[model samples]
Target: MTADGTAPTEEVGGWLDKLGALLRTVGLVVAMGETSLIARNIREPEGATAAGRAMNPGLRQEVVCQPDATGVPWWFWVWQGPTRDAPGELEPLCPAANLEWAAERITRVLAMPEGPP
Candidate 1:
């Protein structure tokens, strides 16, 4: 039980680990942090900006799994800028019930080519 008397929710690490492994097999690198997981294209050297851009034009993607005040575990992409009083630039890709589904969505987006199809 939590401090608010509600039952604890399942931790997200296991799901993240599974997703990370899946990404690794396809040549991407997953970096797990305390509060987030970042997946980057690993085909280029770390300092090779031109090569990196040529390989994967999009910036590294991030996923954050955390509970809101109500103890509902929400999964979403980490926004790259400061929060504003207005609506955020990006919306939640998945609901609180499933992180794996969200990860799959991220994978699909990452796999897309940089320009028009």
Candidate 2:
């Protein structure tokens, strides 16, 4: 964390970078979001033509740092049924250091109806 609000470790950045590359090859858009990283899908909108497609922010998750016995561990966490005051809403996805598992699980949501979803 810094004045610019990006994550402190390049470990986080590096994981995101690699994940971004994999995601793009499969047609997902990846970028640094307001607080962390975001991957979105562009599905065909009704009446879609030369106009814009609907950007669905599916499976919105953000990276968070938590303390561990070894060191500070970075993770991507998604909020489930969040309320205004509940700190227990977040559930960890995967360690930010493990991009292969993360990207696979994250992109699973994009699978077509006939594929493994």
Candidate 3:
């Protein structure tokens, strides 16, 4: 990854750029609904709680965004409220079909703006 946090590969960079944009756009939509999408991963904690019994714990990250409040574009809203550990309830920010529709639009938007070769 670059010091600026961008991917090194062109393909990966392109995808990241698009995803970043989508994340921002969707985040706005989510914020407008008075919620946040805590995008994070699930990690198992160390150690055991009982004899011969290991208690694994999961950890996830979260971020808050506001509606019509343009500033932090990476933040999102949780459509499925909160979860036990892994961020939000893995809620679908948008339905699969709707995502497809938005993706198509994103593709067109990105295609319209080409970088230097």
Look at candidate 2 and tell me the lDDT of residue 16: 63
Give TM per candidate: 0.58, 0.57, 0.22
Candidate 2 stretches greater than 4 Å from native: 1-7, 45-72, 84-88, 112-117
lDDT of 1 by residue, 1-117 (tens): 367643343356655666677777766778986545788764443455776677665547887666655666566677656656554234555654564576567677666454444
The TM-score obtained by model 2 is 0.57
Per-residue error for 78 in candidate 1, Å, reads 0.9
Q: Give one digit per residue, the lDDT tens place, for model 2 in 1-117.
A: 444554556655666667778777877777674335666655444454553433442434344434233454445554545676766445566666676777777677655443333
Which ranking of candidates, highest TM-score first? Answer: 1, 2, 3
Winning model by lDDT: 1
Model 1: runs farther than 4 Å from truth?
4-10, 43-58, 82-90, 95-97, 112-117
As for model 2, its CA RMSD to the true structure in angstroms is 5.9
Extract clashing residue pairs from model 3.
Answer: 36-77, 36-78, 37-76, 37-77, 37-78
Off by over 4 Å in 3: 1-34, 46-56, 67-117
lDDT of 3 at 83: 57
